[model samples]
Target: MIKFLIKGILRDKSRSLLPVIVVATGVFLTVFMSGFLKGIFNDIAELNAKFNTGHVKIMTRAYAENKDQVPNDLALMDVKKLLSQLKIDYPDMEWVKRIHTGGLIDVPDSFGETRGQGQTIVTAIDMLSPGTHEVERMNIKKSIAKGSLPVKQGEALISDEFAERFGVSLGDKVTLFGSTMNGSMMFNIFVVSGTLRFGNTILDRGAIFMDIRDAQLALDMDDAASEILGYFKVGVYDDIKAQQLQASFNTKYSLKDDEFSPQMFRLVEQEGLGDYLKLANSAGTIMVFIFVIAMSIVLWNTGLLGGLRRYSEFGVRLALGEEKKHIYKTTIYEAMLIGIIGSVIGTGMGLGAAYYMQTYGLDVSSITSNIGMMLPSVYRAEVTPSLFYLGFFPGVIATVLGSALAGFAIYKRKTSQLFHELEV
Candidate 1:
């Protein structure tokens, strides 16, 4: 019986064409919007992970409290040993140590006198690790506008904007003047190896990148780190998994008696991030909801239009001794067929477009540079499992619901009235 109904729907263009088109259009929008929004959310989360926080981060209890200050005094001790143990225990995750500090970069002239000065936020990460693609992962190499990656000791990368502001260039001798973890003044001379632009206003303004070993020596924090960042193999943030990991880690390393205990934090739990992530997710939900509601109304109206056009057909069926219920059920089955066909076509179109967007993202660098936010310039679509069936929810539900409501008129028509109405 279902096969017969599908055959009838295929043969009857008047009954199937408009509804199929309507459903396809609605589902297309649904799939496209969902993928687009997912892309934006994932982009924001990934950028956050790459630049500031990872999926999970481990910090000293005191440092977590005063994290905004980038307090190196409460940095983790014996970081190398802890990292090695973590690698052995959790091979699925990649962990890296980082030191965050601030200092004055002085570009010296031929006479060794200060030619330019700029305050910088210094970040130190593992550049020499043969096993890790930290430089590529962070996109530092791609962001470089001049020179190349640091290849030797005492070499560093400064933000291109910072270099321009300070009248500095590649291979320029620059001296970093900052205080050590113990409150003693420390200085390190480095030759600028490259100029990079991260597209982040704050980071690009006065950011300096150095090798982790160099930072450790200069900051007087040997074998210690301000924070340890951990990421999953997928290279995307998973809030639920991060929370679970944090719970498990914190439970095992309870701070009951120790004031200097290490604490684990999910990406969203980091400073000033919880609200931002929440807002972004909430906006995506609202967008999907809006699409569903709008599509439902559109398909609903299409169903009503199709039902009205089939009024005479319904009357003729009832006149031929067919039950009103049977006619209504047939209409629903036909709607289902249309919904399925439309959804398949629409999902295919949406996925194709999404793949394109994902591969070659739209560049928004011009706008991002002026906003002074930590947003990436390229916006790409992120295709997920939901993209396959996301359209079906709106397509089937809206079509079936609209048909069910519109088909109610069949029950109201008496046999005599149906026959009389069948005339013209």
Candidate 2:
């Protein structure tokens, strides 16, 4: 019976061609949109992880509350000792130390007088840490706009925009003046080794990156760091695991009833990110639902037209003593086959497009520059397991649902009436 139905559909283009095209087109769009949105969210999360927050972070309670000030005085002391203990305690995760501070960069002319000066946000990164992949993880090699990464002490990477504004270039020596952890004056001379462009407005405006040892020496903050960042082995954020780690670490390390005690925070806990991510996920779900409803309505209308066109055929079958229930069931089986075929083809095409987008993304530099947002130049699609089967919900289910609704008309067609209508 199924073979006969398949053969009939093959012979009749009107019964299969248009419906297949509609279902395939709808499924293709559904898959593409899912991948595209997932890509955007994933990209943003990674950027935040690398630039602002790690998968998890540890800092002083006072600094966590007043982090906007870049409070070096509240930084963790004896970082090497603490990190050693942390490594032994939690060997599953990678750890990196960082110092955040604010300072003034003074560019000098040949006469030793200041030529230009800018207020800058400074980030001190571990340059000589053994067994660390911070450089590769941050993509510092690719983000370099001029010169190269710093290889020696007293060298730093300044933002391209900051360098341009100060009329500075590679090999230029500059003075950085900042406050020490003990509320004392601190200053150091640094040669500009590289200029970096992160494609982010915050970094481009007035940012500086320096070696951790140099920063510690300049600030007189020996063996101290603003925060200790933790990353997963896979370099991806897992909310539940991160939160669990944070809870365990805080419970173990945090001092109770002490304002200066250190505390741990998951990526989602800091900067109100938990709410933002939840909202973005909800928005994606709403978008998928909207697409499904819109496609279902369109397919439903097409099914009604196809059913009306088959009125004569149904009448002939009814006059020949075929049961109405049997005719209805056959229509459902035919719709199921069409749904399967269309979904398979559409999913393949969508995945191919997604892979292309993932490899070579669309450049939106102009858009990001205009908005002054922290966005990358290229936007890519993310292909996941969900993307592979997400289209099936709308493709197979909607097609079958629309076809089933249309088939209900089979019951209203009386044999005598249909024969008279057909004979006329």
**TM-score of every candidate relative to the true structure:** 0.94, 0.95
Quantify all predictions' global Cα lDDT against the true fold. Answer: 0.83, 0.84
Name the candidate that leads on TM-score. Answer: 2
Tell me the lDDT of candidate 2: 0.84
Candidate 1 lDDT, 165-281, residue by residue in tens = 878879888999999988899999999999998777888889999999999999999999999999998777777777777887888764856767888888887756778778766
Tell me the spans in candidate 2 whose CA falls farther than 4 Å from its real position: none
lDDT of 1: 0.83
Off by over 4 Å in 1: 1-4, 272-285
lDDT of 2 by residue, 73-115 (tens): 9988878988898898888888888999998889999899999
In order of listing, the candidates' clash counts read 0, 0
